[model samples]
Target chain A: MHMLLNTDQSLTQRSEHALKDSFLRQAVQFTTERLREKKEESTNALGDWELWRERGRQIRAHTIQYLDYYLDQFATNVEQAGGQVYFAKDGVEAAKIALEIAKEKRAKKVVKSKSMVTEEVEINTVFEKEGIACVETDLGEYIVQLAKQTPSHIIIPAIHQTREQIAQLFSAEQGKAVSTDTKALTAFARQKLREAFAQAEIGMTGCNFAIAESGSVVLFSNEGNIRMVTTLPKTQIVMMGMERMVPTWEDLEVMANLLPRSATGQKLTAYMSILTGPKRSDEKDGPEELHIIIVDNGRSKQLGDPKFQAILHCIRCGACLNVCPVYRQIGGHAYGSVYPGPIGAVLSPLLNPEDEQVQELADASSLCGACYDACPVQIPLHDMLVYLRERRVKTQGGIEKVAFRGYSAIFRHQATFQWMMKTLRHVQKWSVKDGSRWSSFLSRLPIVQGWVRSRRLPYSTQRSFREQWKMLQKELEEGVDNQ
Target chain B: MNREAFLLHLAKQLGRPEIRNPPKREQIGAPDHWKSFVLPRKSERVDRFCQEARTLGAEVHCFETQQQLQEGLQALLTSLKPQSILRWDHTECPAMIDSVLNRWKSRIVDPIADPSQALHADVGITTVDFAIADTGTLVLCSDEQKSRGVSLFPAHHIAIVDADQIRTRMGEVLAEFRGGKPPSAIHFITGPSRSSDIENDLSIGVHGPAVLHILVKV
Candidate 1:
C-alpha cells in the first residue's frame, strides 16, 4: 500500500510536481468549486448561518473542554452495552491493538470504510504485513486503494483522479477491460465490493461523532458502504480520534444540521447511521462484537495549548479545503501528509511536531483566513498556521530570525529607518531598467530571490513614503496660501 | 493503555489532576429560534416530506387507507417484478400485504434468524419509526424484528409510514433519544444509496438499495 506521506521530497518540490500535472490542478479546482458552491447554497437555505456556526463552535468547545469526563462516561456506556473500548496513546499502539484483534479473530480479510485516523496510523500496511487483506469499501477509497495511492481530500478522497484513470485502475484489478463511464465503473466496484463484504470477517469504520450519553458512534455517508461494513462482518472495529465526541444526542442534532450542509450541500447525507453497540441478542443483522479504539496520536498535546485547542473542534467537513486557494491550486499531494489543505497544514505539524518534514507543511498556506470562515465549527485554522510557523521559527532559528532582527533594528529608530530607506532607493535605481520598470536583476538578488520566485516584486518608488508625505504636506501648505 | 490510565493522562494534559465536572452550559441544542421552527399541520408536513423525498431521488406514494396502501404496494410489486421480497415482523405493518407479496417468494425476517436471506432478496419492506419533513428522512431503529439488513441489503427498499409519524425537522426526531435508551442502531435514510466519489459525478446504488419507495398512509 502506498502511503500519502512522502516526506523524502520537500513541500516546494512536491508542489512543483503537482503544478506540472494540469489534470490534477483542474480536477481539484473543479471539485472544490462545486463543493464550495454547494456549501454556500445549503447554508443560505438555512438562514442565519453565522448563528449556526456559532452554535456549532459552542457545542464543540463545550465537549472538548469536558472531554475527559465524556470519554469516561462513553467508555462506561460502551461496556454496559457489551462492547469493549481500547485507548491507544499513539498510532503504533492503535495499529498494534487492531492487529491483535485481527489475530484473535483469525481474520483473513477485513473490509474497511474510509477513516483518516486509520490512515494516520498506517493501519492498512500493518494489516497487509500480517497477511490480512484490508479492502477499502468506500467507492472513492476503493479507487485510490486500487491505484495504490492515498486519499488526496478528506471527503472526496480520489479528487485527483480522472474517470479514465479510475477505469484503468479498475480494469487492472479485474484483469479485464472496463469502460470510462461513471455508472459502469461504479457498477463494477459495487459488484466486486459486495463479494469482499460478505467474505470479510471483520469490518472497520471511522467514527464521525461518538455520542457520550448514548455511547453511539454516528456516521455520515452518501454511499452505503459504511452500513455494509458495519452490518456484514461479525466483528466491527471503530477507529475514532479521542476528540471526536459529543455530549449528547441533542448536540448531535446541531452537528447533524451543520456537517451535511457544509459537506455536500445536502440537508443530510443519504445515510446517517447511529450504531450504539454490537447487535442485540435478539437482533437479526448487525455486528456481534464491537470494538472501539480511541486514539490520541498527539491530540493530547493540544489540550491546554490555547492557540490550538480550537482545532480539536473541527468536524472534518472539508469546508476549509474547498475555500483554500493554496489547496485548490497545488492539490493535496503537495502537502505530503495524511491530511491536506488548511487543516493539514496546521494539524500535520501539531500531530508530529518533532518531524522536520511534517513541520514544513505549516508553510504551505497563505494564511488568507478563508479556512476559518469556511470551517463549520469556526476553528481558526489560519491563526493556527501562523502559530505553527512562529513555533517552527523559534525552534529552528534560521536566516528568518537574523533578517527580522536586522529589520527590527532598522525600524526601531526614525533616523536609522530614513537612512536605510535612502540607501535602498539608490539600490533600487541600480536594479531598475529604463528608469521606470523593474528589471530581472531585482529577482536575481540573493536577498529577495525567494520572494520573487512565485510573485512579482513591485518597483520601488524614487521617494520613500516619508519623503512622499513631506512633499504632499508642502503642496498642501502652498495651496492654502494661494487660496 | 487501559481506559482509566488514558483518562488520567488526558486529565493531566488538560491541566487537571482529576476529571473536571462538566461546565455549566448556557445553550445546548440549535439556536433558540430554530427550536420553534415546525410545520403547523400534518398534511403540510406530509406534502413537504414527499416533495423533499422525491428531490432526493426516492419514490413516494400516499394513500387514504390500508386497502389503498395494499393496492399501491401490489401495483408497485407487480410492476417491479422482484424475484424475492423481505418484510419486517411488526404488528403495525400491514400483514395483509403478504397476499400481494405471495406472487413472489417472500419471508418475514425474524430478528434472531440468520440474515443471509436479505443478501439475495430483491425487495425489503419495513414500516418507518418516524419521518422528517424538512429533509424527507426516515428513521429506522433496529430491533429483534426490525432488522437493519431488511432495509439495507436489498436492491430496492419500500418503507411504509403513517402520516402521523411525519415530524418537522431532524431535531424533533433526535429529541426523542435525549433521555431514553437508544436502540442498537438508528438509521436516518434520506434517499437511495448514492455516491459522487467518481469525479463528483453522482451514481446511485453503490452498495445499498439503489431504489427507495416510501409509502405514506393518510
Candidate 2:
C-alpha cells in the first residue's frame, strides 16, 4: 500500500544508508535544532505551555471520539456550500477521484501546493500517467519534484538537499546555470511557478483544518502558494485525512494557535486562507468548483482500539521530528513512508498493516518518549510503537523472542535468576574491562547480538544487589553493637 | 465508496452505531487567558504591531489624521510609480483612499476583468476587514466588490487598515464568525509571503506579494 518511496530496501537497510550519509546527518541535526529552539522560545512565551498542549489534545480527542457525527455534519455543510464531497476508502480511490475530476474537467495541467495526502495517494504520479501535468508549487516540493524524490521533511520537504544540489536541479530545469544564491534561486522558482499557476486549469491543496460548521477548508502557508492554487484554478480539489476536522471556527482558533507554533514557532504563517466551497456565483475569483475528498486509508481501523485511537489526533506539526533521537540521526527518508518521525513510525504500520516492511519501523525508535513530550496533541507515540512491536511479535519471532524466552525462564524462579545474575557478574568481572573495546565481541553473541551492536553495555557490577544488601545488613548489625 | 459505507466502517470500528447528534461543547476556541489577554493600551498595541510587522519584513506606516494619510499614501505611491495598480472597490474603504487612487485613476483599470492584466498588475491595494495586532495580521473577507485576488495576484501588496479595527489576538476576530456564514474567502495576511524551505535560507514574496506595505490610519 506504500505509494511513493521504493520499499525494495528494508527499513533497517534504508536507515543504514541514511546513517552513512554524513551530509544528511548534519543537515537533519541543524534543521531540527533550529526548529526546536524556536519552538522552545515561543512555547516559553505562552507561560503554561503544557496547559495549551492538553487543551489541544482534548480538542482532538473529542473530535475523533465523535468523528462520525462531525464528519457527517461536515459533509452536509460542504454540500450546502456548493462543494461536492467524496469519501475515499483508501489512497488509490482518493487519487482516482482526483484524476476523474481532472479528466472530466478536461484539464491539461494541475497546479498543486504541497499536500502530504496527495503524496500518500501518489496523485501526481497518477496525473502524470494520465498525461496531465501536475506541478508542485511549494518551493520545497518543487525542488523535490525536480529532483524526482519524495520530501524528506514534512514542512521543509527538501531539507536533505544542499544548496549546490538544489542549484544543479534548477539549472537543469531552466536549461541554464542557476546560481546557489538563495535570493536568485527563489526568484527563479517564483517566475517558474507563477507561469504554472496561470496556465493550470485545476488546483489541488491539503486542508489544514476543515471547519465542520462553515464547511470551509483552512490552509496555512508561509509561501502563499496555497492562495495562488485555490484562486488561479477553475476547479479545486482538496484531499484531507478524515480526522482533519474541528467542530467550528471557534475551535479553529485553538488549532490556529497550536499548529503554527508547534511547526515553525510563528505566531501565524504569512497567509491563513479559509475557503468555504467555490467562489460565489457573482464573485470574480477563487475556484469555480470545489471538491473535498476525505480519505480514510486505515484510520478507521484504529477507531475502537483505545491504544491506537489517540494516534489520529496528530496535527502533522512535525514537532516530534525535531525531538526524536532516531529521526535526528537518520532523516525522513529512512522511515520509508509518507508520514515520518515518531508519528510516522506508529502511523505507517497502521496505514499499511499487512506490510512487514512498515512494521520494521516500530523498532527504529529507542522509545525515549521525547516525541510524546514534544507532541502538541500528546499522542503517546512511544507507547504505540511498543504496542506495534507487541502486535508484530505475536505474528513473528527471531532473536528477540528467543532472548525473551530465556529471560522469562530465569525470571520465573528466584533461584534461576540468582544463579544467572551470579554467573553473569563473574563473567563481567573477568572480561568486561573496556565496554567499547569488548562490545564487538559481545556483538558476536547470538541472543544479545542485535542489542549490543549499536550500543556498548557492560554486563553488571562486581557485586549483585542481593550480595550488597547482605553486606549492608552485616555492617549495620556490627555498627549497632559498637554504638 | 459511498459516504454511508465509509461512515459505517468508522462506526463499526468505534464499536457503536452511527451518530448524527452530540452534546455541544460549553466553550470552544482558545484558552481563557489567551482569548482574554490584551495589550495594556492602544499605543502599545500599535507599537507591537509595527515591530512584529517589520520583523516579518513588511513596511508599516501610521498616520494621525487623514491629511497625513493622504500625503503618506501619495509619497508611497509616488515612490512605487507603478505602471498599473489594482484596487478593490470596497465601500468599507474610505472614500479619501479611492480619491487618492483617483489621482492615478488611469492606472486603476479593472484588471479583475482580465486575468492576465490582474497577474501582471504592478500593485494590489485593498481594505482589510479587520486586523490582529498580536501577530500583525490583516483579515480580508471576499465579496463581489472585494475580490480575494486583489490582495494575492500582484508582486507588491498594500493594505489600508483602520486602527480601530485592530484587535489583540486572532481569536477575537474568529469569535465574530460564530453565528453566521463566513464569506467565501477570508485571508489572514500576516506579512509578505515568505519561505524558509530552501536550505534554511529565507526568500520573501515567493508566490504571493514579495513586498507588503500596511498603512494604519489612527
Candidate 3:
C-alpha cells in the first residue's frame, strides 16, 4: 500500500500527519477498544484459551515447516478436482496472472471479497488501469474503495472512517445525499453490489486457509459478500499466500475455532464456505472456472529464518492491531503498508527487506507483548520486534544508531551521566516556562522534539537521583543528632 | 514463473530437500479435552443447540410431532408471505415435510433452470445434513440436488434438521468428512448473514438471509 506517493518521509512524519486528524484517532480508538473488549470476553468464554492458541500455533507451524510438501499436495488435489493453479514469486506477477485470466475470459467486471493479499498486490489498480471495473463487495471495503484508499484494518477495513464519512462516500456515488443511518447505508451497498454481483464476469477472493487434503479454499466472512463473489461470477480467481496451508480437514476445524473468536468474537463467522473446486458438472451456482495464484513474494525468505519464520503462522486476524498501543495511538496509515499494527510492524519489514521505509515499521510497536497474547497463534511479535530492530540497525547504519550509542556510553559511566545531566539542566534554562512547567523550550530541541511534542521533558530534575538521595541521608543524620 | 523454481526455493529456504509425500501429523484437529465436552443426551444436545441458535439471533422452533411441524411450517411460510419458494431435493427429507411442501407452490432448485429463480425467491427451504450444538452451526453440503443458492441469496431461509443429527462439537462432524468424496461446497453457517462494518454497527442481511428460521424435529 505504499500510498504515501513514495515520498522520502519518515514514519514519524506520517504518524504526525495521522496524529493531526483527531477524527482518525477517535475512530481508531473506538474500534480497537470495542474489538479488544470483545476479544477478551470471547477468548475467556472459549475456556482453556491458551490450549487452543497452542494447538493453532502447532498446526500453523507444522504446515509452514512442511509448506513445500503441503503446497505440492494442495496443487495436485486442486488439479485433480478440476481447478488450475498458478505460482507467482511476487505481487506484480500475481497481479499480472490475475489480469491475464481476466483478459482471457474477457471479463469486464469483477466483484471482490475482502482479501489483504489482494490489497497487497493492488489487483484492483491493475484491473482499473485496463478499464475493468473491479468492485469491492465487502461493505467496509466498498467504503474504502469509494474513498480511493487502502483498508486501514484487516477485519474492519474502514476502521478509521466514521459513519458520516461513509455516508458522504455513498452520497457521492448515489448523486444524492445519503443519510448516515447504518441501515440505510447498508441497504444502499447491498442494492448496488447485488447488481454488480449479478453481472460480474469474474469473482476474486483471498484464501483464508487452503486445505491440502481436499484442495479446498476456505473463506470466512460475516457479510456473506464472499459467497456472492464466489457464486455469482462465471470465473473465479483466488489470491493465496504460499504459506496459507493446512494438511487436512481436521486441522481446518482448529483454524475455524480460533480465527472467528480472535477476529470478531463470533463463535463462527456467519458464513464459512469451503469450496473444493469449481462447481461440479451438475451444480447450478459457483464459479465454473477456478484459478488459484500462490504468491511467494518474500515469504520464502522467512521459511528458514529461526527468528522470523514464526511470522508465517499469522492468520491475519487483526487481533494484534486491536491490542497494540502504538496502533491505537497512530492508526494504520502511519505504517504506510497494506498490513498495519504489530503484525504489520514485523511483516512489512520482512516482506520488503530492502525498503528502508518499510523497515521502519518494525519500530511501530511498544514491545508490550500485548500483541503476542492477543494473537490466536501466539507469534512472539515483541521478541520479533527486537530481532527486527537489531537486524535493521546492523544492516542500515543510521542517526539513531549514533544516538543510542551515545545514550548507552553516557549512562554506563556515572561521571559522564552526571555531566550530561548537568549540561541538560543548564541547556534547559533556554527553555521558556509554560503555565506550570519548565522545558517547553526543550521540547523544541532538534533530537527530542518528536518525543516532546505531546509530552513534557521533565526539566532534567535540577539534581540527579543519587545527589538527591545523598542529601536526604545527610538530612536524616542531622535529625538524629538533634534527637 | 516456473512452479519448480518457486517450490524449490521454498524447500531450500526451509532447509530441507523436497518432500514428496504428506508428513505424519503429530497433532490433529481440536485438543483432546474439547471432544469430551459433550452433552450427555440427545435432548440436552437439542436444547443446547437451540439455546445457542437463539443467542446467535436465529429463531429456533422445536417440533415433537408431525402436527406441530405442520403448524410451525405453515406459520413460518405465512408470516414470511413468500410468493415464490425454492427448496433442495434432499433425499433424506421426511415424507411429512414433502407433503407439507406440496401444499405450497414450491419446486426443487433446478440447476438447469434460470438462476434468477432462486435470486428472486423470497424464501428458501433446505434440510441441513448436520446440526452442530457446540457452535449452533448448520453444515450444508451442496451437490447436484442440494444447491447453495437455496440457503443463500434469499432474504429468509428455513432450515429443517432432525434433532438427533445434532452433534456435540464441530470436530465430531468434521471428523466424518476425513476421507469421503466431499461435496463441492460445505458451508458452516452459524447465524444469519450479518455485518458490523459500518462504524461497527451490526446490520443483518447484508447480502445473505436476514432471518434464519431453524426447524428442529425432535
Candidate 4:
C-alpha cells in the first residue's frame, strides 16, 4: 500500500509513465475497448437489460439494508459447516489475523488466487516481511508478480502487459528462451502454477458472494485456479468483503445473471464453485480446514448512510472501468489502489478517508453517467463520486474548503457571479491556443487541477444560456403586451 | 469465540439502533415474464433443450425405451473402464443396473457417499429430478439416492432426466426448492466443467468432472 502512497508521485506522474509506454497503452486500450464492446453486445443480447439491472439493484439494496441479519446467518452457517469466521474491523486487523494464521500454520509457502481484498490488506508484502514465500497462481497475477508490480485492472490484472512482456517475464522465470506465442506462454504459466498448487501449504481466495443460509462462499471464475486453491490445499482461507452476502441460493440466481454478464459478457462464468465450510466429513478432495475472514475494512461504515450506501452494491464487474473515459485513457495504475474506475474513485476515498493519498481519487470521474448506465446493479457511481467529493470538502481544512467557499461565494451574490463570468470571458483567451484549448494550465493552478486535466470546456458560447433565455423570454412578453 | 460476544460484535457493526423490521421484498429473481415462459410438449421441449445444452458443451443422449437407457448406460460403463460408479436415489433407472455395475467390479453406492470417495470413483450416475431448458441447468435435490457431491467431484457424471421433468424457466425448478427446502444442498449445473483461466485458454475438467453425460428418457 505504501507504493500507492508517496503522493510525491501524483496520478499525473504515474499516468505519464503509463502513457509513455506504447505497449502498455495499446494493451490497456485494447482490453478495455474489447470489454466495452462485449458489454454492449451482451446487454443488447439480453432483452430487457434495464429490468435485469433493476432486479439486481433491488436485491443489493435489500441485502445491504439487512446486512446484519444476513451476515449473522452466514456466519452461523459457515460455523455449522465446520468453518471458522473472523470479523476484522479494518485492514490492519485483517492483515494481523492473516499473519497470525500464517504463523500458526508455520506455513513457508502460500498460493493465492486473484483477490482484491488481499491486495487491499497488502498481504503479499506482509508475508514477504515475515519471510514466507507467497506465489500468485492466477495467470495475470503471475505476470504482475514477476514484474514486482501491482494489478493495473480490476478484472484483468495484467491488462497493461503486452504479449512480448509476458514472454519476457516467462523467459526470465525459466532462465531459457520462451516463445511470445500466447499458447506457449499460457502453457508455461499452467506448468508453473500446477507446481505451486501441488506444494503450497495454504490456499487463499476472495469471496464473490457468501450464501448465509448455506454457509457457502460462492466463487465465480473463468480460470480453475480458485477451484484448485480451494480443493487441493489442506487449509483454505477466504477473505470476503463484509457486504459480499446474499440472502439465499434464491438471490444467487439474480447475481448469477448480473455478475458474469457485467464482468466479461459471459452467459455464466465457466466455473462457479460453492464451498460449504471446509471439507465436510464425507468430502474427499476439499480443504481439510476452512477459515473465512469477513473483512469490514471501511464497508460497515457505509451501512444506513443514504448518501454513500449504494456503493456497497458493486459486484466488481469492471464494466464501469471499461466504459470510464478516465480509466480508458490513464488506465488503473493512476488510481493507485486495489480498486480502480468510477467505483474505485468513490471506494478508495471512502475506504481510506482523510488519507491524503486517496483524497484526490474522487476527482477522477467525468460524471457522464456512463458508469451508471454500464453498472449491472445500477449503482449510481457518478452520484457517489460527487458525494465523496462533498465529504472530502467537508473534512478538509485547506484548498478544497477554500475552493468550495469561493464557488459558493460566486453563486451567493449575483453581482459577483456576473463579475466572475465577465472576468472568466477575458481570462479565457489565454486558454484557447491555436483552436485546441489547453486544459492542463487550469488544473495546475491549484487544488482543483485534477478535474480540469480530465475535461475540456468546448469554446464557450458568445452568451451564457441563462442570459440568452432571459432575453428571449423578455422579448416574447413585450410582443404579447404590444399585441 | 463466544457466541454471545460474537453476536454482540456483529450486531454493533450493523449499527445497533432499535430494530426496525424492513418491509418484505416481493420482486426477486427473474422478472414475471421470464417465469411465465412455457414451451409446448414436455417430450419435444426436452429434445430441443437437450440439443441446446449440448451446443453449450454438455454431452446429451436421448433414449426411447427404458431398455435403451440401460443399454446406453452399459455402453458408457464399459467404455469408461471404472472399478466403481456412484448412483443417485431415483426409481426410474433400472434397479438391476446397480448389480450389473457391481458385477463389472464397479460397485454402485448412494449419491451422498463422502465426496472424497466420489472423487475417486470412475463415474457418478444420478437421475436429475428437474432441468431448465433456457440456460441448460439441472436442479438436483438432496435425497437418499442423490448426494450433492455425486455430479460434482467425480471424473465422469451421468445424469438421467425423465422427459416430463424438463422446464423452460429456471424459476419453476427453484419454486420446487421453496416448498420446504428439500435438503441442505441443491445444485444448478449448466454445462461441462470448464475453465479459461490460463491466458483465456479453454480447458475442460480441472477439479470437477472431465465428462458429463445427460440421458433424456421419455
Candidate 5:
C-alpha cells in the first residue's frame, strides 16, 4: 500500500548515509537556514502573520471538510471549460491514465515541470517504459533526472547536489565538458530544455492550487518552466493531489500571499501562471487539449480519521521542512519519500500506515514543536508523531510495553513504590563510587550500559525526597524548645 | 474509477453519504481590516512600485505623457540596440512608437501568424492589464489579441503600464476576477526569470525573459 517511489532504504540507514556526507549536511543546513530567514523577514514585513496563518488554516479546513462538494464543483467547472478530468484511486492508476493520454496523443516526447504527485506515481518510469522520452524541464529536476535520483528537497530538488556535481551532470547530458559556473550551467540547461519544449507533443505540470470557482490551475515558478510547459505543447496534462483545491479566486489571493513568502521569501515567485483551460479557438499559443488527473492515492484515508485529517491541509510550502532541526541535520534523503522533512514524517506514514518501513519514518523527529510553529496552515505534526508512535507500540508490543506496565503497577501502589525506591538506593551503593565515579570500571557494566555508553549516568542522591521531608518535619517539631 | 464512483467513494470516506451544499463563507477573502486598508496616493504608489520593481531586478521608468513614453522607448532601443522587437496588439500602447520601432525589424503580435517570430525576437513589449505596487507584479491576460508568448519567449520584456492601473496589493488585483470567467491565461510576472537551482546561486533568465523593464506612464 506504500506509494513512495524512492529507494527502499530504512530511515535509519538513509540518515546514517546522509550524516556521513558532510557536504549534503552542510548544504541542507545552509539552504534551510536561508529559506527560514527569508520567510521570517517577509512574514514580519507583511505584518499580521498570525492572523493570515489562521485564515489559511480556516480556508483549508473548510475546503477539506467538504472536499466532495468543492471537488465536484471543480470537476464540473473544468468540464464546462472544455477540459477533461480523471480520478485515480492509486499511483498505478494515475500513471496509467497519464500514459493512456500520452499514447492517444501519439506523443513521442513529453516535457514536465516539477510535480511531486508525478514523483509519487512514478509517472516518468511509466512513460519511459512505454518508449516516450520524458524530459524534466525544471533546472533542479533536470539535474536530478540526469543523475537518476529523486528530489531531495521540495522547492529546490537538487539541494543535495553541489555545483561541481551539477557541472558533471550537465556535461554528461551535453556530451561535452561544462564549467561549474552557475550562469554557464543554467544556459546549458536552457538550451537543452528548449529543444525538449519545442519538440515534445505533450507537456505536464503540477497544479499548485486548483481554483474551484473558475476551474483554473495555478502554477508558481521562478524559472518560468511551467509557462513553457503550459504554452508550448499541443496536449497538456496536470497531475494534482486531491486536496490541492481552493474555493475561489479570492481564496487564491490568500494562498498567493502565503505560499511564496513561506517558500522562497518572495511576495510572489517570478511567474504565477493561471491557466483556466486549454487554448481558445483564436489563441495562437497554449495547449489545445488539457487533461487534469486528480489522484487520491491514499489521500482519502485521512478524510474520516480525525487525528490524521489535518495532514491533508498542508499547502506544500516546505516551511516546516526548513525549520525542522532533524531535517536540517539529515537532509531530505533520510525521509526516503517524495516528500521530506516534518510533513514527510507525518504524511509518509499516514499515507500507508500498514507498511513497516513507512511506519518507522515517524521515529525520525525530535518532537520539538518547531515544525508546528513553522507550519503556515498550523498542522500539529508533533502531536501526530506521538499518535503514530502510540499506534505502533500498541500494534507491535515490545520491551517498552513490559517496562511501562511494570512501572504503572508499582506507581499505582504507594507502599510498593516506596519499598522499590528504598531497595534501589541500597543497590545503587554497589554501583555508585565514593566520589561519584564508578567504584570500578566493571561496576558500570549491568543495567545502564546502553544509556551510559554515550553519556554519563548521574549518581542518585543518598537521601530520597521523602526521607529528607520527614527529617525536616522532626527538626521543626524540636525547634520550639531550642528557641 | 469513474467520476461518479470516485465522488461517491470520497463522500462515504468522509462519513457524509450525500454531498453537503457549500457552506456560508464568513471570511472568504482577506480579513476585513486588510480589505479596508487604504491604498497609497497615485504618485506614492508609482514611486513605491518603481523602488520595489527595481529591488526585484526589473528596471522602471516613469513618464507623464505618450510623448515622454515614446522618447523613453526610443532611447532604450538605441542603447540596447536590439535586432528585432515584438509589441502586443493593445490600444493602450501608443501608435507612434511603431515608427521608432520600425527602424529595426518589428512586428505587432496580434494575429500571431508565426509563434517563432516572437520567440526569436530580441525584445518584446506589452501593455499590462494591471500593476501591483506592493509586490511589484504585472498581470497579463491572454486573449485573441494578446499572445502569451510575447511576454514570455523574448530575451527582454518591456511592459508599459499606466500609473492609474497600479493597485496596492495582490488581493486588489485578484478581486477583479471575482466577477466573471477568467481568461485562458493570466500571468503575474514579478521580475526577470530566475533560478537558484545550481547550489543556490541566483541566475537570471534561465527560461523566460532575462530582463524585465516596467515603463510607467504617469
Candidate 6:
C-alpha cells in the first residue's frame, strides 16, 4: 500500500492532471454520493450512529494510548491460545519475516484475502520474487491484480474498473468471451477461485480486530473468502497493525456494529469469523499452524503527540473517504498512496515524513471538517491537516517567516498599514483586468504560478468593504449632526 | 519459531507496559430507548430476522417435522438446479434429517473429506446450534459432530435450527460460549454470502453460499 511513486513532478502537477480527468471526477463523485446516502440510511436505521461512533473512538483512543499494554497482552494471549505472534518495526522487517516464514514452510502457493498492511509491505511482490505463487482470493483484489493496477478504493479495490473490463479479464481466463452482466462475470470468477482456494499451501489474512481477552482474531468479510483462507490452508498468517487490538470481545461487539454499518451499511457483514488458534488436536478443517504479525510502521510516532494521536484511532472504515470533498473530486490515485482521501492526506505525509517531498500533500485538503464528522472514531483530520501545514512552514523558515513578520509589523502601526493599502489600491488600477482589479496581477504573480495555472481567482471589487462601510458611517453621523 | 521466543520478541518491541486506567465503556449500540426493544412472538421475531436476512438474499423456511424438512431438501437436490448439495457429517445422524435424506439420490457426505466435491453442490445442509434474534445470526460450533465446510464451502447452505434454541439477543448466545469450554470454532452467520466488490454493486454468493436457507423447526 506504500509503493513509492516517483515524485518527479510536484504534488500540484499530479493533482492538476487528476482534477482535469472528467471520467475520474464523475466516477468518484457518483460513487461517493451513493455510498454516503447508503451510509446515512444504514447508520440511522441502527439509531444513535454518533454514539456508536463515539464508542468506537473511545475504544480505539484508549487502546492506542495504552498500545504497549494491549499489544503485550495480545501477544501473550495469542501464545497462550497456541498461536505464534511477531512484532515488526516497519514494512521491510515485516516483509522479511513473512518471506522467511514462506521459505521455512516451503510454500508453493499462498492464498491471501485483502489486507492493506500486506499491500503496505508489498508482501505479494516479495513472495513472487522468491518463486512462490501468491493469489489474491478477494474478488476485487483478483480483478485489480489481473489489471496490473493498484487498488483505487480502500474497500472496493477495483472501483475504477468498468464491468466490461472485468468481463474482459474473466474472458481471458475462461478462454471464451464473457458478458458484462454482473451475474455472468461473478459466476465465472467464483468457479475460477475455488481451485486456487483448494490448491494454496498457505493462507494469509488481515485482522479486523485482535481481541486480547480471549486471544482471538476477528475478521469481518461479506464474501467469506477469509473463512476459506484461514480454514482451508495448512498454515494461516494474519498481518495486523499494532493499533488493531481491543481489550475484550465485548469491545469487539461495539466495533463490529460500527465498522460494517459505516463502511457499507450492512446490518451485519454476512460472516463474522473469530479464530482462536489453529485447528486443535481433534478439529478437522482449520489450519494446522497460525501466526499473527503485529506491525508498527510509523504508528508509534503518534503515540505521545496529543495533536496527531487521534489519527491512530481510525477503524479503517473509509467513512472519511466517502464524505471528503477533495477525494470525491480527485479520486484515490492523486494521493499517490494506498490510503486515500482525508485520512490519507493526513496519514501519508506523517508516515513517510520526507518533508522536502510531502509538504504540498498537507495543503491538498480544504479543511472543511467533513472527514471529522464522518469518522467513526472522530479523528480530527481537518485540524491535523492545518497542523501539518503549520509544521511544514515552521520547518522552512523562508517566505512564510518573512511574510508573517512583515504583516505583523504593519498591523502594529495602523498609519503604515493604511498607507500601504492606499498605495496598493492606486497601483492595482494599472494591473486591472477589464473592470476587475488585481486579476491580471494575480495571474502574473510568480509565487502563485501553480495555483493560477490550474484555477482562476476572483478579482477584487471596485471598492473594499471597509471603504464602503466608512462612507456609510460618515453619512449617518452627518444626519445625526443635522438633527 | 517457538511460542517462547515469539513472546519475548513481542515483549521487547512493546517496551514497558503502560498502567491502563479502568476504561469508560460508552453507551455502545442501539440507543438508550431501544435497549428494551423486543419483538412480540417467536414467529414475529423469526419473520423480522428472516426478512432482514432475505433482503441480503438469504432464503427462509419454516417446518414442523424432520420429514417436511427432508422433502423440501429432496426437491432442492432433485432439481439439481445448482448441481450439488453439501451437508455436515452430523447432519446425517440416523434418527434425524439423515433418516429421510438417505432416500435421496444425491451426493450427501461430510464435505471436509472431499471438500472439492462441494464446488457443484446444489444445496448444503447443516444444523445450527443456536440463533441470535437481535442480529439474526445463526451460530455454528465446529467439532467432531459438525464440519465448518457445510456452512461455508458450498454454493447454497440449508441451516437447520430448532425453534427452542432461539435467543433474544447476541449477548445471551455469547454468554453461552463463555460459560463452557467452547468448541474449536464458533461461526456467526447472519445472511447469505455476498460482496459489493464491483463498485458497490452487491453480488450474492460470489465466493460462498449464494442461497442461505434457515429452517426453524417447531
Listed in order, the DockQ scores are 0.78, 0.80, 0.79, 0.24, 0.79, 0.44
True-vs-predicted CA distance for residue A159, candidate 5, Å? 1.5
* TM match of model 3 to true structure: 0.92
Cα misplacement distance, residue B152 of candidate 6 (Å): 1.6
Docking class of 2: medium
Better of 1 and 6 by TM-score: 1
**Residue by residue across A186-257, what tens digits does model 4's lDDT show?**
667766776777677799999899876677888876555676677667788888888899877677877887
Who wins the DockQ comparison? Answer: 2
Instruction: Flag the better candidate by TM-score, 3 or 5.
Output: 5
Residues A1-483 of candidate 3 have per-residue lDDT tens digits of 242323567888988899999988998999999988888888888899999999999999999999989998899889988999999988889999999999999989999999888887888889999999999999989999999987888889887888888899999999999899998998899888988999999999999999998899999988889988888898999999998999988898899989988998888899999998899999867889999999987888998999999999999899999999999989888888888899988988898887777888888877989999899999999999999999988889678788889899999998998898888777665544331344565555676676666665565445778889999999999999998
- Which segments of model 2 are wrong by more than 4 Å? A3-5, A427-443, B24-27, B39-44
- What's the CA error at residue A414 for candidate 2, in Å? 1.5
The residue-level lDDT of candidate 6 at B87 comes to: 64
lDDT of 2 by residue, A1-483 (tens): 674555689877898899999998999999999999998988887678888888888889989988988999889889998999999999989988999999999999999998888888889889999999999999999999999998988978999999999999999999999999999999899888889999999999999999888788999999989999999889999999999999878789888888998999887899999989799998888899999999998888889998999988999999999999999999999888998888888998998898876788898898999999999889999999999998888778876787789899999999999998888767767785435556667778775676566666665566878889999999999999998
TM-score on alpha carbons, each prediction: 0.96, 0.97, 0.92, 0.82, 0.95, 0.91
Candidate 6, which segments miss by more than 4 Å at Cα?
Answer: A412-416, A433-444, A453-473, B1-17, B20-41, B65-71, B78-84, B91-94, B179-182
Write model 1 residue lDDT over A323-426, tens digit each, in one string. 99999999988998898999999988898877877888888888899999998899999888888988888889788889889999999999999998788777
Model 6, span B1-218: residue lDDT tens: 34344334444444544445434555433344444656668877776666665676667777777688777766765665545566666634436677656765355654655566754566777888888776778888887767677788777788877777777666556556553345657788988888777756778888878878877775
Off by over 4 Å in 3: A1-9, A405-444, A458-483, B106-111
Best by lDDT: 1
TM-score of chain B of each: 0.91, 0.94, 0.93, 0.80, 0.91, 0.75
lDDT of 5 at A230: 93
